[model samples]
Target: MTPGARIAAAIDILDAITAGAAAEQALTQWARRSRFAGAKDRAAVRDHVFDALRRWRSAGAAGGGQSGRAVMIGLLREDGTDPAQLFTGERHAPEPLSHDEAQVPEPTPARGVRWNLPDWLLPEFAESLGAHAEATAQALQSRAPVTLRVNLRKASRAEAQDALQAEGILCAPNPLCATALTVTEGARRVKQSAPFAQGWIELQDAASQAVVAALPSGARCLDYCAGGGGKALAMAADGRTTFAHDIDAGRMKDLPSRAQRAGAAIRLLDRAGLEQERPFDVVLCDAPCSGSGAWRRAPHGKWTLTPERLAELTAVQDSILDTAKDLVGAGGHLVYATCSVLRRENEDRIAAFLAGHNGWFCRLEQRFDIQQHGDGFFTAHLTRVKL
Candidate 1:
C-alpha cells in the first residue's frame, strides 16, 4: 500500500474505534476484510491508528474536526506531510483535501493535548511527580522504549545481545536493571528473532525487572497475583522454585506453555492450590491498579480509568495483599508492588499495611521513576520481625 493508502486505512479504523469498537477489534475487522493488504501494510496502518489514538485530542484539534478525514489531515499536518500530494484521490488513497482542508493551522498547544493525557490526570501527575511531572507527562506522549529480559538460565547477556543483533534487532544494556536490554532499533523484528524464539529473552520493562531484582532471594517463592506470569517467569530465571497463583485460573492457561519454553518450573496454582502451598519463604504481589505509569505502552488504559474505578482497584489490591500475607511463613517477606506512580497506590498503601499489621518492619523501599528507561514502578519489602 502507498503512504496515502495507509493513512486512509488508519482513518477508517479510528472512526470505528470512536464509534465504540475496541482498537484491536476494529483493527482485526479491517485486516480480515482487506486480505489484499500485505503484512507490512497492515502493520503500518495499525501503527498510524494507534499514533492517532495516543494523541486523540491533539489530532482532533489540529484536524479542525473529529471526522475520519479530519484526523488523517491532523496526523499529516502534525507530521508536516502535504495532504494535497498524498490525498490525490488515486487508487486506495484518501480523497483530495478540500480547499478549506488545505489550510493547515499553526501548531498551538493546549495543556492536556501537550501532555497527551486527559485533563483530570494533569493535577494527579503534578501531585505525584512534583517538578518532574511535565517531563514524565511528555514522555507518555511518545512511544515507549522496548526492553527485553535476558534469561540467565538460558544465555548470558553478551550472548543474547549478539543473537538479537544478528536478527537485525539492536539492543544495548539498560541501566535500570542488569538483566534488561533496551531495544534501540528493529524492535518490530524482535518476536521473530532466534533468541526470543529459543526463550533466551522475554519482553519486559527495565523497571519491572528491577522490581523483581530488588527482592530478597529465596528458593521457595509465590507470585500471589501472577497475572500472565511475567514476574513468575522472572523469578524462575533467578533460580527460584516458583509457584504462581491468581484468583482466576483461566488467566494462566498459557503460562505452562511459556514456562515449558523457558525450561523453567513455574507451577500454576488456583485458590485451593495456594491454600495447599502455604507458607512460602517469599510472597510477591504485583497488584492491579490504575497503571498510570504504564500509559505510554497502553494508552487506552489511561482514558478508561476513573476515580471510582481506582477506588475499586485499591480495594482489590488490599484484599490480594491480605490473602497473600497468610501464605508467608514466620520470618518470611511480603513484598508489595504496583506500576502506578500515584502516592495513594504506592507509599500510602504500604504505610497502611505497616500501620494495620504490628510486628512487621519495613526493609527496603525501591522506586524507579518514569525517566528510568521504562515505566515508573514502586516496590516495598516488609518482613515479619516478631512473628
Candidate 2:
C-alpha cells in the first residue's frame, strides 16, 4: 500500500476507535477486511493509530477538530508533513480536505492538551513528579524501548547478547539490571530468534527486571499478585524456590508452560494452596494501578482511566498489601511494587501500609523513571524490624 493509503487506513481505524471500538479491535477489523495490505503496511497503520492516541488531544486540536481525519491531518502537520499529500482525492487515499479542514488551527493553550493527558491527571502528575512531570509526560507521548531479560539460569549476559545478535536482534546492556538488555534493532525478529525460543531470554521491561533485582535474596519467595508470572519466573532464575499466585487463577494458565520453557521451576498456588504454604521468606505484591507509566504501550488506558477507577485501584492495592503481609514471616521482605509514576499509587500506598502496620518499615525503595531505556516503576522493600 502507498503511504497515503496507510494514512487513510489509520484514519478509518481511528474513527472506529473514536466511536467506542477498542484500538486493537478496530485495527484488527481493518486488517481482516484489507487482506491486500502487507505486513509493513499493517505495521505502519498501527503505528499511526497509536501515535494519534498518544497525542490525541494535541493532534485533535492541531488538526482543527475531533474527527479521525482531522486528527490524522493534525498528526501529519505536527510532524511538519503536508497533509494535502495524504488527503488527496486519488485512489486509495483519504478524501480531499474541505476548505475549513485545510486551515490548521493553533492548538488550545491548555496543559492537558499540551501534555496529551486527561485534565484531571495534569494536577496528579504535577503533584507526583513536580519538576519532572513535564518530562515524564513528554516521555509517555513516545514509544517504549523493547527490552529483554537474559535468563541467567540459561545463559550469561554476554552469551545471550551474542545469540540474540546472531539472529539480528541487536541489543545492548541495560543499566537498570545486569540481566537486562535493551533491544537496539531488529526487535521484531526476537520472537523468531533461537535464543528466545531456547529460553536464553525473556521479553521484559528493564525497570520491571530492576524490581526483581532489588529484592533481598531469600530461599523461598511468593509473588502474591503474579499476573503472567513474569517476576516469579525471574526470581526462580536465581535458583530460589519461587511460588506464584493471583486472585484470578486463569491469568496464570500459561505460567506452567512458560516456567517449563524458561527452565525455571515456579510453583503455582491457588488461594487454598497459598494458605497451605504459609509464611514465605519474601512476598512480592506487584499490585495493579492506573498503569500511567506504561501508557506508551497502552495509550488507550490514559483516556479510559477515571478518578473512580483510580480510587478503586488504590483500595485494591491496600488490600493486597494487607493480605500479602500475612504471608510474610518475621524478618521476611514484603515487597510492594507498581508500574505507575503517580505517587498516590506508589509512595503514598507504601506510606499508608507502614502507617497501618506496626513493626514494619521500608528498608529500600527505588523509582525507575521513563527514559530511553524503560518504563516507570516503583518498588519498596519492607521488613518487620526482625524483633
RMSD of each: 1.8, 1.2
Collision count for each candidate, in order: 0, 0
lDDT of candidate 1?
0.85
Q: What are the lDDT scores of the predictions, listed in order?
A: 0.85, 0.92
Model 2 TM-score (2 dp): 0.97
**Model 1, range 179-224, lDDT digits (tens) per residue?**
9999998988998888988899999999999989888867799998
Best by TM-score: 2
Q: Where does the lowest 10-residue lDDT sum fall in candidate 2?
A: 101-110
Q: On residues 1-387, what C-alpha lDDT tens digit does candidate 2 reach at each position? A: 989999999999999988999888999999999999998899899999999999999999999988889889999999999899888868799989899989879668889988999999999999999999999999999999999999998899999999888878889999889999999999888988899888888999999999998899789999999999999989999789999999999999989988888999999998899889978999999999999999999999999899999999999999999999989988899999999999999999999999999989899878999999999999999996777
Q: Candidate 2: what lDDT?
A: 0.92
Identify the leading candidate in terms of lDDT: 2
Candidate 2 clash pair list: none
